[model samples]
Target: MKPPCYLIVLAFLPSFSFCEIVVKGDGILQDTSLTKNEATPTKPQASKPDPAGDDLILFDNGDVMHGTFGGIQGGLLWERKDIDRPIKFSIPAIRQVVFKGSSGVVMEKETSFITLVSGDRIPGKIVSLDDKSLVVKSSVVGDLKIPREHIKSLSPNPFDGELFYSGPYNSNGWMILDYRKTKEKDKAKEIAGEEKKPKKEVIQENGKVKEESSAWIHSGASFYSLDNRALVYPDANMPDIGRLKFKAKWKGRLNLTLALHSDFTRVLPAEKKEEPKAEEAEEIEDGEKPKAEGEQKPRKKEQPEKQDPAPLQKERLVDFRKNNAFQNIAWINPSKRTHADMFGTGYTMTLYSSYPNLSRNYFSETGVARTQRMASVRSNISLSEGGDAEIEIRYNRKESLMILFINGTYAAQWNDLGGFPGDGTGFGIVNNTSNARVRISEVMITSWNGMTDSANSMIHPDRDLVLLGNGTDRFSGQVIEIKDGVALLKSAYMNAEIPVKDLSKIVLKKSTSTDLDSDDLSEDLTWAKEPMTIIYKPFGKIRLNPISAERNLLSGNSPFFGEITVDLSSAAMLRFTEGSPDLSDWFDDL
Candidate 1:
């Protein structure tokens, strides 16, 4: 059988974004972002595990707690444990819960169109709006909280990557700085040529000609990629990245910073050499003019010696540590000035700006305390008057770098002195205009774990334990020490070691938790050791290494229970205590 012509055509169209290239029966498309090809089918498939990344709970103050996610039990957390004294949270105290991976998620975006008093529009999802503050979420930048007074009104908006704040933006969650916006070029030309028309067509409104033909000028701004050709479509509709941070040292070692690279090539005129004076001297040795010979051999103007063009300036690559480092940064607004920023080791700081086109200068705090003085930055970067732009402000404890790119070109990079930034460093936006207000779609302060190359692995199981002598006997706790293969278990009441030979079933805990178990657990306390679930019941379902169950009595090792030979004849079950690398590497592998 022959494939349909359109399917054959689709095979060659490089413009399409099909995940698979196989031909279809009638050319009908298939949605296979998830699952597998249907050609090989089985009776049925088993239920899948949660597809998100690590189950992380972030605190409002910037601290993070990792756990296996024991669901809320009796208004208390259960399943896994890794928390400090009085392990408790009201659920509302959490800033957000970042799931394990992006699988099973729709990846759809719901945005809020914030209309500032200046009539500017920005898009994001409204997380909260109260008298004190307004918190918005972006698939790009995670969550952003702003002061209430800084906003005027908010309305829902459809998520379109290139629609408003998407073009040329990225998943890093663009902070649309609507400093200025300009109209389309054709509209500008139409208005320029409008004056040439008949006087009768030049009707004036509000002291200006109302040229409907030139209306396309204010159709809102658009953006292009670094090449300035393909329209940029920042995939900003992610569920929640939590943060976009990397280590001060990991700038060039990871995907986020490595992807920010841009190169520049410049050509300079060759140096001119002074021509010898002897030619002119020979032309007029004596002041007297000689009689012209018949058609005096036309002395071709002595061709000046050809000077070698100065070797083309070597193409330059952006250095995150040097001056004008942001020369390759991209921008969406139009400005004529540029700024510079610096970054080194230890501390980190950055500046964000959304300035009007006429505002020739902006200021930076770098990493220093404000002395009521704003360090002005003169910029050579420009975008449309009403469009927005963002800057990359990376700071260390001793230095900070601020880079701004505009209209697919490097604009400015500002460096200053201050402490390096840690997690949860907050930032804000201030409107310098009264009637021309702007909306800051996001105020991103990046933070993540892979910012360094230290040898230590930052991940461990949230909780680890073992089940011995038939599933009925269980012990949950940390493995403090191992001696000659005999593992030591540290539980609340006792710390004992169990031999490897006695092992029946061992469920590996995947997260590290700090919450202390209750000193008084019911004899029936039990939990299933799944990826993100807990089980606590059904004595018949319990299975484990065979136990010499002389009647109901069973033997297990314990510290507090003392007697080298412990018996579980009186209890129902047992429990244990719970919970980085490549990367870019998943934590579950360990």
Candidate 2:
């Protein structure tokens, strides 16, 4: 095939430049973009009004945008919709704003309290937040329990300065800015103590204005210092009233606050054990002889325990395999339960987590190939034939399970050994083959890569773009390699690989990184219409091969294999699941 030529494209490859851009909101734009029919929900695509656009606007928080309507306004993109209802929020709430670098969108609302895209509702006061989670407090909900990844946006009610008891035991009173230093407050107290006569202001018609005492807690990014501050215990009896003082900083080195003095007894070391030791070590002189390695045994490094990477929720794939004896007859029931399954005389088979090479010969109602063969290996569960088959696989933080359905009826069950060689530990599926006629019409897998809801939306790129490592959206890119069951994307600036199952939605967007005229830019993904080639080089070495169901798997009636080679590199991959296989079975049992 001739390499089609076009003018030089603005290659924003490997340059993961940090920039913020504007996302403009044109009033009442016709929203014709179709919702991607993904098992998992995804972020909506923006309709490109005109391409050839230049001058990307970066937001205050370092987000960049480039489409027809893109720009930052007041810490958020102006392009977002204002969903601030009168009762929900007096402060304006932006509905939907696209995050920079990828197609993720952030949604905001008010009075809805706190509901994450994942469906967890956190009802309480939001004390603090970051990109991934938030800390909230409520008597009913107790404390911070929601992660930011689950949230779409935060909606804070407008402060009315009215003290209301929102919690079971505490009242969120009016926030008065008490800027007076400790000395100034002390002087006021001394003066109040020196009063000789009954104070007219303190006494009302029936009673005196009582002084309110409570701890002011801030959970912002700054580190807090609790120096000699005493927390009053419920059981402790205090003499009339007493006070405690301490300081805390947000995202800083030290905390500050005045010491507390009270008759109520609650005593301990002022600082935590680790914090003081760290401080003490820093104060040691440079010339002073350090303790011998054995004398003062060095503290063992507390390595951040490696978290088992998130699990990949996979579905089954039933295609043709060369080594399998049942090439003509798709195993109506393959004993290997975890990976792929077949039934309906090979006409209708279900694929669970991964796609496999398949042939249409088995799909025909009747033929010389209408003969079934035993599975290449035995699966923990046996598969039975008759009627259309469906494979259901579920994934969680740890493992994945597979279930088989015949003619939409329950048939078989299996636990994926997890990785190849049945370690039951790895993610993704490969190194196996199946032959069936049915087109893999359905594939459902749980994912963490991208999620969507009223509050948050994430993008799960198709196989090609995800391998780019940088996670930037490119208009024209191709699949170059499948290493260790992972697909690698090749482009001028980007060279990265991703798990094949990670491909949920592939989007084609107008490249807005460099300066170009609006007339030259096209919003639709015209390039994607051409066939994408997945080059396979021994699943380890870089190679190119057109990954077409027809080309490599079958030519008319005969099976053929071809090979091409290429150079490739690396990219980090993140997998997440929406549901667990165990949960699916348990729910089914109920």
Candidate 3:
């Protein structure tokens, strides 16, 4: 009305050149020139090339780099071969650092392992126990005084049985077999005629020929499988009565099949036997010659064929599923064999994600031939995706029982009337889902004493709890006092004194005077507004705020436990949570 429309547009044209509107991936338009000094946008620098090094650094975005770790002060300092100077990375942006060829402290004798309420397990000798605190002498930290309220369980003789295997310390003797390649090879054979065997790629190194396939990435104390592959520990000296325990963390569904007492090292095709010709069959029958139409033949007792003495074998007294009481949800016939079937004459425990979770155990008499579901249980605990679990399987052949414990709680047990199967002393794990990624650590196999672990009792918020040695033994009352290895309980029925050695676990009543919430009481320590988590070797994890790392010693202040120092060698990994200003923001400043 006052000026023409063209005149108004011309007035704002000069101001438009000062600010450039940029649309980001989030669909937000940003005035770049107004916020930044330059009009030209800076491109992100390319990631540095990985160098040949032992230590590995994992970032939050799943990028990994090989470098030498210098140490940590305010942040971590890493040295890369391609770079002349050491690079400093913010702690919040790093996932973990894995040191190759690093073995933690080894305990020579028997030790007591204590599981804390926060889920950190400490291996040490119990120094003293009382109503106030429990003192333990650790090989790594010397001694630690833990509060009674923080302890979840105490195992006096954790390593009571003979240890057949305890490591995964490195990727020296493990075998990773990729099933996808096998499927592809079979498909190629079907199209190119079965008479021609598919050629396989082989590599020659150190005067030896080896076949190449998918391999599990060994990072410090863990083994990671990106694709669905089977990992086998061949020729393991497994005992008849033994225990298998390991910790597994995964992304997406954790579909895993564990094989115990397996006989085969690798999956083999079924051997086909040709039928005898009619003429040959008639000649064999004629040789028999209708043994004496009327004459009685002298019976001769033939001596058993002499053969090399076999290893100690146990007789199968009872048949599994003798009565067939439990309903069979699925049946695997002898004719059908999948690539996932990697073992012969053993037991397979499958873990599924579908609810009633459908955790099942199946036995195969001859590989996939005549496989039957022995027992199945609908797990009450939900193993959600992207979570972790501590799984334990105890097999007692003498007792004809196999028990499963998840996260220290008794889950289910299977009885085998047919007795243990297979003479092979090996174990294997197969990932059933191709899209899922799995990480396994802390693999331990040891002899069992034919006794199942007691199931932990539910903690009552109002009353003190005590669980005894037996699975079902439990008591709820106000704990009067604990002195001289005996606990005094005052209940409405009676005031009883029980020996602590006979008790499996004890949960004390919570105090009401604290202003902090119960959940806040267990919060991990924080530094620079970022939480820190430390993983220990064998099995253990704790959270604390690191002050400094020098001379291979990490000093930190814990929220639950006060100031403490731990050897860096004992630590398997360290993780940090993101802060307000992350590494991406720091990069923008440059």
Candidate 4:
């Protein structure tokens, strides 16, 4: 078989296809039936793989190949776009390979120039280079500045070794150099032209940053870091730049006072070097310039410094145990209170007199008058011996319980007093058969104790106590006390205080009455004179006129005239005495 001639012509064209490579002396394309001579195929060159240090450049295609260096000292490697293999390069051949990303500019040929991603490029002699940034200087574009982070890789510029003066020893780190030796023609003026003039000073004080002594500004208010590269300060939003004045002090340890504002030019007392003299002030006023102070003095401007508000006052606590005992007594009495009075407006002062020897024959002239609801009678017994005895009388009311207690014991109960025997002045002992001398001590008249409501804690307004007596010769030296359903008394003469309980046997007795009037029809005595009219404060006298002459019989002869009916609701204290209606004349009225 013979080889095809068309396949032979396509091998040597380097720009035609990407996959196939051509070989001239090798018998790869010869006849299949014939064997080529292994010796001397036109003195064939060695096509061994390229060394790793040899420059190889890669294109966008999936081709792999070896290519020759392109620049002055083989500093660059290039390959045709129609190659069938990846192109490679020596690491040293790269001067400055800047990757400007998709639409960025590439370096044109062999100029010391590199274009930026924005297609702006300038040629320069590289002065310094590092991963972070780069410095370059050349005659074409004097002092070209670039960031090394923008460059993909770099080879050290040979000219920068000696004149750049790499400083000091370093570990595996980058080194800095002095780029001062590199000079350009009239470079100073060009540098001045590229620099900006001093406009205004903006300083940060307290929490605010201010400029032009006008307003405060924040970082993003008028300036922004564009992709962390350049600071973009828009003209419309450019901050007013100036200086500021400040004042400060220490309120206490760990606390500070800071106030900052405009007007920073005036010299302050803290920074003053010396006092001004009168002669120097006059000389300066004569138009000579003042000599310079050693350093600038900062003025202290007045401001509202931070301060704490006034602290609150707390209430004081007190202990209650140390006070006096009298302060704890709740002292109160009924007579001193004028608000709710049961007694009438005026009191009958003469009604407390004692009376004696009452008689019914004198009833017309006396104050004793009969009434259906009340009457009074008294039984007189003669005493042969002056000895002590009790007068036990029981006059019971059918509608209500009536008890007369003496000295804490029940004395008598009146269960039938509602039916008076004749509305008459009678002389009868409510109780019978007595031998001891008698005297009336105290009396308490009340409604049924059990029938009244317990909730009414106060004494019933309808209930009260009364006491009536004769002269000192008859019924003297008596004491009376009343509270709750009880009464107490001590009699004169014998003066013994007795405990009287129960109302069943109220007895008035004589110390010596030898013979009893047993079964005698007329033995019970009738009252010969009217009884004394006992005027009371709480209860009205029902059967008598208070101003009449019946009160004078307290020492008279009749039995009924000396009798006294105590309406317990009326006079709490009652004294009936034999006198000219004058209490001082009754000896026992006291």
The lDDT leader among the candidates is 3
Candidate 2 has a TM-score of 0.17
- Per-residue lDDT tens digits for candidate 4, residues 1-590, read 22245344334433333234322223332211101111112112222324322222222221122333232221122433334432333322222111101111122222233323212233333454333445555332245445432332221211111111111110011111001223455577656754643323223445343321101100100110001011100111101111111111111111111111111011111233688999999888898455577855556788888886434322111111122110111111222221001111111000001211211111111222221211223222322222222221222223323222222223333332333221211111110112211121112111122321111221122221111111011122322332232324345334433221211111111111112233542333332333333222211122221222111121122221222222222121122222211111111211
- Report every candidate's CA lDDT: 0.29, 0.24, 0.57, 0.23
Query: If both were scored by TM-score, which would come out higher, candidate 1 or candidate 2?
Result: 1
Backbone clashes (count) for model 3: 5
- What is the TM-score of candidate 1? 0.21
Off by over 4 Å in 4: 1-54, 57-62, 69-135, 138-143, 147-590
Per-residue lDDT over 266-325 for candidate 1, one digit per residue giving the tens place of the 0 to 100 score: 122235688869878876777646667675665679889998644443221222112311
Which candidate has the top score in TM-score?
3
User: Alpha carbon lDDT of residue 286, candidate 1?
Assistant: 73
Please list the Cα RMSD from the true structure of every candidate, rounded to 1 decimal place: 26.8, 33.7, 14.9, 64.5
Q: Whose lDDT is higher: candidate 3's or candidate 4's?
A: 3
Q: Which order, best to worst by lDDT?
A: 3, 1, 2, 4
Better of 1 and 3 by lDDT: 3
Task: Give TM per candidate.
Answer: 0.21, 0.17, 0.61, 0.12
Model 1 segments beyond 4 Å from truth? Answer: 1-53, 68-70, 74-88, 103-304, 311-355, 358-590
Worst ten in a row by lDDT for model 1: 214-223
- Give the per-residue lDDT digits (tens) of candidate 2, residues 1-590: 21122111112211212221112222221121211111111121222332323212222222223332232222211222221111111011221212122211111222113444322233345554433345655322346444333343232321111111111111011111112233568778877765853676454325534432211221110111112111111111111111111111111121111101111111111232455666577777554676876697668899998987344322222222222111111222222221112211111122332221121112112111232222222123333221122333212223323233323333343332421111111111111212211111122222221111101122222222231212233223544433454545666777766553333322221231211234654433122222212111111111111222210131111011122211111100000111211011111211
